[model samples]
Target: MKLFVDCKKAGHLCDKGQYEDASFFEKLSVRMHVMMCKQCAKYSERNAKLTKLLKDSKCKQMPEECKKRIREELARELAKKPE
Candidate 1:
């Protein structure tokens, strides 16, 4: 199987817990490839730094009522059964 050009990109997507998350084995394979490739290692370092900066920045907070309503809507949605 082919490996991803940037293992950090795979890790970033994996962190999001999204439906499109890459498989652990696929990421492990990419990590292995990166270990042997200097260019990929630098790319991974840059991506990691960017991710840290983005996560560290402050953002606006939602109001308490809005947060509660959003939670209730999510709970109701989660309770629904799939066809």
Candidate 2:
């Protein structure tokens, strides 16, 4: 098993881990990278905080009618735009 990872791969793993979609090895690699890289560590920290905030929030979803109206407005705007 490869123990080291580059920043980009580390970042991807961080996001996947945040969503509980990464494998154990991938999460481990990301943890190792975060331990050594300050920027990635900060990024991972912020991502975790954001995830927690989103999970904790009591936000409601828009109604279907509201979503339909927004889509209609977008379609109208796109029709008016030049090709």
Candidate 3:
């Protein structure tokens, strides 16, 4: 099952804080996997940085009007795209 838990999915789990609920065996498994997976370790670091950036700016609010306009533009762009 170790092969099933590749760095990508493990990184996703780590991002979602699944480590808190992981069993001792699972934790050891992930630890061992990450030790050899530089790509996953880098992914974890990027996730951490992004999470910190988002949390630190949690109070900064986007203007509703600006958001609406951006959404509308995105919708138009999406509509123009071919399936």
TM-score of 3: 0.49
Better candidate by lDDT, 1 or 3: 3
Worst 10 residues of 2 by lDDT: 1-10
Q: In candidate 3, how many clashes are counted?
A: 0
lDDT of 2 by residue, 1-83 (tens): 67799999999899998899999999999999999999999999999999999999999999999999999999999889587
| Per-model lDDT | 0.65, 0.94, 0.70
At residue 33, what lDDT does model 1 achieve? 60
Point to the candidate with the largest lDDT. Answer: 2
Which regions of candidate 3 are displaced past 4 Å?
1-4, 18-29, 62-83
Q: Per-residue lDDT tens digits of candidate 1, residues 1-83?
A: 55554555544543432333557666676577668777666765676677678778897789999999999999999999987
lDDT score for residue 62 of model 1: 91
Best by TM-score: 2
The RMSD (Cα, Å) of candidate 2 is: 3.2
Per-model TM-score on C-alpha atoms: 0.47, 0.80, 0.49
